[model samples]
Target: MNGKGTKARWWARTATTFVCVGAAVAATAPSAFAGATGCNDRTCIAVAGSGLRVESVTASTTWNGDFNGHLHIYGGGIDRNSATGFWGYHQKFTVPVGRDLPNGSVLCAEGWEHTGGGLQLRGRACAEVHF
Candidate 1:
C-alpha cells in the first residue's frame, strides 16, 4: 500500500502541534517584563517589565501634535516619576546603564492630550515587574 499520503498527514499534524506549543510558551513566558504590554485606543504602552527592555518604557501615540507622552516607574529603582516630556519626542534622552530594581515594582506610561481646559489625561498602560 502507498504510504505517501499517511506520511504527509502525520507531518502536518506534527507541525501544527509545534506551532501551538510555541505560541503558548511565548505568551506565558516567565518574564512578565519581557512578554507583557498594555494598549488602548489612543496609545500602546510597554514598560521596563513589559515586552520592552527592562530599562525603559515607550510612550507610544500617534505622531500628531495633539498628544504628549510621559514615562514613569513605580519601583524603588528610580527616585521619582519623570516630568512631562522627559521621554517625549522633543527631548533628547540617553539610556544609562540598567539598574537593579526592587522586586514587584510596576512601570507605567501615560498619554496626555492638549485640551481646551489644559493637558488632560488621555490614556495609560502599565506592566507589573517580575523577576
Candidate 2:
C-alpha cells in the first residue's frame, strides 16, 4: 500500500481507541451529586441568645454561571443537591419567627465538595445576615 494510505489507516485506528477509552471512563464514573434528597430536613430556626424557636429554613436558587447555577439559602439547610455540572448542593426549608424573626438572628450556611474519597465543606459560607 502507498505511504499516504498507511498513515490514514493508522490515524483512524488511534481515534477509535481514544473514543473507546473515553466511553469506558465515563460509564464507570459516579455522579457528582446524590440527587435532591441529601438536604431535606425539617428543622426550626431559633433565636441567637436564648435558642428560642423563631422561623424556618427556605431554599432558593439563582443563576451564578451560564452553565452552572448556585444554591441561595436564607434560613436553614434546605435541599442540597445539584442536578447538573461538576458538583452542587442545594437546600430549602422554613423557620418560625416571632412574626418576623426579630432581626439579628445569625444565618450560617456552607457548601461542600466531595474529593479524595471524602467530603470537604470548601468553606463556602455566608455569615450573619437576615433572610
**Which numbered prediction scores highest in TM-score against the true structure?**
1
Backbone clashes, each candidate: 2, 20
Cα lDDT computed for each candidate against the true fold: 0.52, 0.37
- lDDT tens digits, residue span 44-120, model 2: 12223222233333333222312133233454333344342342223332233333333344443333344556554
Assess the local accuracy of residue 124 in candidate 1 as a C-alpha lDDT between 0 and 100: 62
Q: Quote each prediction's TM-score.
A: 0.48, 0.30
Q: What is candidate 2's CA lDDT for residue 57?
A: 38
